[model samples]
Target: MSSATNSQLAIRTRSWMFTPATRPDRFANAAKSQVDVLIVDLEDAVQPDEKAAARGNVRTLLDAADNTALPPLAIRINSLLTRFGLDDLIMLLDAKHAPQFVLLPKIESPEQVLQIDTLLTAAGKTTWLVPMIESARGLSVVEPIAQSCSRVAALMFGAADYASDVKAQPEALALQLARCGVAAACAQAGVLAIDAPCFALHDAERLHADLTFAAANGFEAKAAIHPSHIESINTTFTPSAERVTWAKRVVEAAEKGAGTVDGRMVDEAIAREARRVLAAA
Candidate 1:
């Protein structure tokens, strides 16, 4: 997918699925899975020996017009601190195929975003960015990082790494503040905040609880570890039928000026929320 296509998808994305760049065959499957965003990981998911191979696979996958029919696609590069990162940038920047988004892992400051934005500009690419906040330092400066560059379309939370950094168990409640912090920063920057994936893919109850908690805490989307988790995440993040109905009612009443719905007042703010619910639905 091109960056233009990615820009549209970023506005209302809910389910973000990560597929390893090492497995190009899975790319088509991930695209067909109806995920809002499909990310090809070249970072933690790819080993040192496989980095070069994964980069080639990602380049070939992107170059194919047949692959462009997929959903909004992204490439998660290795950290700038590593040797592979510069090579990843050089190859991707010169590629004929354009990826809509570039996922930057372990982002710690706004300057890092600015530097990347500059390079992409120099290369004459319109690729957007998704900064991964994986540590305490990243969480602290997340707001600035989100606002650092216009190229940034979303902010992703890395729960496992963050949990380790804070010396806490990677539990829903354990990372509550961190999750909330990332969401609040995203809100401040007017960008999407995506929740981290639940490591235990088999725990359906925990997954549901995690989604519910993320939604309540203001995250607009969640990352999925496995393909099976996409549908549940999408359903959980989407506004319900009842919510859409209420939203319509609120909007209709607001159209008639000040009014009440079920003994409660319906004002501009309520109407706005209703509109948002309808949009999400």
Candidate 2:
């Protein structure tokens, strides 16, 4: 599709673009981009010495803008177990405008999500949680993590951290189990499953394969470390026109008590998938 077609697509969870929290020069530009969600990354993108200033930048940006003008905003805070995470939490709570999503990194259990939810509640912010599952421990309990709280919006897989934790390479084959686990858990919770951001910044072929892997395994969205990745992410996650037509046929078949659509069986699971495709479209 052309750039105009991509821009015409409404705001959905198909692509999330990450901007370094420290890059004030690029913040507004990223917000105006075609990315579905603009995340001011406070974790991996900022240095320890600059984390404080990054937090301030986020606050000032939020203070200066009308929320409606921007796409959905998210902040990937450090783990709540760390001092940096606690400080990030405090900054978000005290901000004049709350982000739509708060991405918690290195989340291994449901309790961490609950604690953050409680704090946001006390502070009167309605921000939803996006748990980043990037560890063996986190993947083990991903089901509970995805279903942790009502505010839990999505589960984002962090392959880099998982690779480090498992002493493996950060490739699709190596992280396939972790990815599948996250996707299944998100499905169980009836929330969006976000695949990890493609680190190969300019390798279009690698990015396409990565996105295909995520989609085939049930992930609904993928994160982008750079703006260039947003187009592929959006295109891959979106249901193609042909698939949408097939889904409509499947739905009609199920409603008419037909056993098949174009010779394919329309069982409960297939019918459910068709409905989901329509929803995505």
Per-model TM-score, in order, reads: 0.92, 0.93
lDDT digits (tens) for residues 167-252 of candidate 1: 99876465899999999988787778899998878989988888899999888889987988899988987888888888899999
Error of 2 at 52 (Å): 1.0
lDDT of each: 0.85, 0.85
- Model 2, residue 28: what's the lDDT? 69
Model 1: which ten-residue window has the lowest total lDDT?
1-10
Backbone clashes under 3 angstroms, per model: 0, 0
